[model samples]
Target: MSSAAPQAPDAAPDQDVRRIDDRSPWWGRLRAAVGRSRADLAVVLLFLAAAGWLTHGLWPDPGSRTMALNPADQVLYEWFLAVDARALLGDFGLLTDRLNAPDGVNLMANTTVIALGVLLAPVTLTLGAPVTFALLAGANLAGTAVAWYLLFTRPLGARRLAAGLGAALCGFGPGMVSQTNSHLHMTAQWLVPVIVWLVVRMLRAADPGRGGPDRLRLLSSAVGLAAAVSAQVFVGEEVLFLTFVTLLVMAVTYAVVDRDLARRALPAFTGGMVVAAGLALLVVGWPLWFQFLGPQGVATGLFSPHYFSADLRSWWTLSPLSVVGGDDAARLTTGPAEYNTFLGWPLLLVTVGCALWLGRRPLVVACLVSALAMGALSLGPRLVVDGQHTGVPGPFALLADVPVVDGALPMRFALVVLPLAATLVVLAVDRASASTGRARRLVPAVVGAALLPLFPAPLPTSGRPPVPEFITGGYWRQCVPPGGVLVPVPPATPRDPWPMRWATATDVAFGMPEGFFIGPHGRNGAATIGTSKQPTSALLAEVATWGLRPAVGEEQRRQAERDADFWDASCVALTVDTPYADSLRGTLEDLYGPSTRIADAWIWRV
Candidate 1:
């Protein structure tokens, strides 16, 4: 009877308990992990879809469609990709003569982006540069958003919804969208967050009370930071320079705001930064040398600081890329691709209000200080409001003459404000959500109102001029030898880059005497685009532009022959449908003696 009772009561209960407990530890933990992964996956997919929507203008037909506002920059990037693709196939050189012919161009001196090109060489060589460019543009936007989202959620402890919102602002904000119009160097910022995270880790490791300074952690973080910085240099040195400025401002602000924490963190922070700088030098030193002092290098700055400076009114204006207040704000910006800070007045007002509300947080204070400092610097030497010069000098004037700083477009300083603004918004929302009724509701409502007007619109695009049949159909092989020049009717100058498109279309099969690229001009090596003008090219350009055939004489014909010999010309080809084709053809016929109508071009064998 006792055995029967024990079996009935304990046996069934023990079996049930074992079954439940055995599954709970492993199965429950696995379920939680899968749920977390699924949430992360959902966020990534959402960001990617948003990126696609933002870049919808280019994906339909990248070969034909071009950024309507900045076709020049788009065409320039395509040429860069083509050069990089060719460079990967054992034709690699920091200085390439493919564009400027025998004089050559210093690739390291320009934003050639060889690292990104090599990574995408397969796509570029297979589907062509146009497709690779479009793919990369979308990937940059999505990848940046995803990276920032991870930083906000995992390290900063922001809620998922708040993090998503903030990351969207960082990735698709007015400045980011404006630069995304073919400025791959600025938009490829996914690595920035990783570097920021590593720095934060170093700071934490420096705190003596937290198990007394972790040397190993500090060293690892420093090495990681160095790797990230070196990679960033290859991606975009301008952005990296701006990032350093922002970080310096933030560190100083933090030190002032929280003396105790700063004292604890500074020792490790400074040490880690020193280590990172040393390591980064080891990696990028040679490339830097090649960029600044190598053959064809320009000694002077490329752009004017004052002209490209952001207008003070631009701070309160809306970006033309935004959904609201777009049409009225065009006059406030330099160009469609340079709308760096059209952070409407409403958003600025809200940000200031939130900063005041979250005044106790040290990180919040640092972000506010950094943003304001960067904003002030973005106004350049003299402040301009609504296209009127205010005659008041800006903070940037103090550093304008400094070597590396001189090259920066002062307006781009506004880009540093974007991530800072995003961080402030996320911290505000996350904190407010933890508070009671009225405060939470008011904060969110105001933020939503401010952000709705700044939502991004699809970018504008137009059809690109098609490549000539002679180049695409491979008929140039019959007239021009493998390593010889094919002098286009008017040549490829900065004003008319159409022939650059033709040269790249052939995968750089033939060199050109003239092209749209920066080259050393004078004894001091001041930067100039395209080669020095020759008599033959000048005459041809004049004829093509005004449809007026010049008076052909023996002297002009002799100059043309000398130019052809100088260029090592194998043939001279003029597209049948080029503008003022008859005038150009007459001039070419007079110079070269006769022309053969082959394929879709008038070919004259030199």
Candidate 2:
């Protein structure tokens, strides 16, 4: 034996000798950082590219192009963002007389995405609300995909390709694409994955085999969860509520599938929940209270559960929004924005097979059970297939009248199913990626086939009525004073919402009598789209609807004067090119005398 010890192996010749300098140029430092996160950057870029394609129509002319399927909602959200910008400049309040003037609108009671609006206030104030709306529409889709991708890759141990595919489905699936037609609230789901991740961490901490629950980690995660919950409340309470329900269902299913695991996780989960609940209350309890019980808050459901429910066949039918397999299956859904259950037959079959094949895994079992439960609830109180009622009661009937639950459209339950389906896909793809030979090629091919037909087409858009130069050219500021009303000739209402666009265009320089908003309409604060009709507004609505000029008399003039005074009217303007303009002009002339033609509209100084 050699007396001397073998010399230490020489340092590997190929070992890196370069060190990242702390004092390097900013661009160089940024480049190094980018190099470290190449995977994440690639995923984000891919999602952004997809979102850009989906929303390309709006970018061409955001002010002129509007979602054809739901322009009212697009206009409404534009107004909301404009109002948010105004609020930042000391116009702060949860209620405003900008819309539904005289009576005012309770913004807290509606689907007001205040957090999103505030975040985009700079864009809304500078570029205008239309630009802000377009940007947010695309961001929601891309941000959601990136958020879910992080969750899948970091926590679930999914391969980059697998996670990206799964996240793409969660973000740009048929249902999500349908919602992009102006359902901003429904599309804002980027925070959901953060909440889910915190939940997973809490449950994992409880396992004794995983070093038991770490008190400090649990407390920090609980606080993080609380913050996320509170922020989501401001974004969209409806989505937050659905997320809670989905989590509860997931918890129950998880417990049923693996008693031992659930029992072990119970301690940490319960502790985290208590802490998170208390902190969330501290942050969002007041806003939540105002939303449910403050001035003008609605006390009843705003939508009909039966009308908004998913059709049974919608699960297998392709959405009209799908690029490859689209059909005129409009009867299966309420409208373009509510196509919440258009998972094609092939994807549904694949999901089922994956769930069954991975049944032994507790998490997979929980996802499958939870998805089925949500799917059942999405059928509403009664089953309908192929546009015909089956007369069979659905599981939702039992929960239809439940307080907070009643406010949610049953079809939105399918939104929860989307992520669950994506989870199954991620697991299946991950396993397939790790497999050798035939399984790898076969599995990816099958997934691609199942997912290809559901690829989203760009959202449809159409030209909106142009805002007349009379309003856009700063002429309205001459007729309407600061914080005063500028009543349109026929008065803005849910049906004729063009005038609302004028107010938003001017950054809400004036108020209007009626607008597109949900508020109290009758006793017990029952929800309706607009305020109760004033005599003058009702008369105008009648003329606008029928295009007939009614006989104007002293009594009609007196009523118009009273309404004008009630609204503190400063000006009345009518777009000259509108339908029934002659009738509106005649009625207004009869009531307030001759009007002055200016730019593209007739104006009367009230």
Worst 10 residues of 2 by lDDT: 1-10
Candidate 2 residues lying further than 4 Å off, grouped into runs, are 1-36
Consecutive 10-residue window with the lowest summed lDDT within model 1: 1-10
Question: What's the residue-level lDDT of 513 in candidate 1?
Answer: 81
lDDT of each prediction vs. the true structure? 0.82, 0.83
Q: TM-scores across all candidates?
A: 0.93, 0.93
lDDT of 1 by residue, 1-606 (tens): 001011211112212233455458777656666766787799999989988988878877798888888888777788888878886688878888777777778887888777788788778888778887888778888899899998887667666666777898888888888998889989888988988888778877776756647899989988999999999887888888998899889888878877777777678768878998999999999888988888888767788888888998899988888887567677877788888889989889988888898765677788899999999999988898989988899998998889988878999999978889988887777676656778767777788888888888888888877788898898999898766788888888887777888777766767888778877775568877766778999999999889998899999999999998888888889999999999999999999888998889999888
Question: Model 1, residue 417: displacement in angstroms?
Answer: 0.8
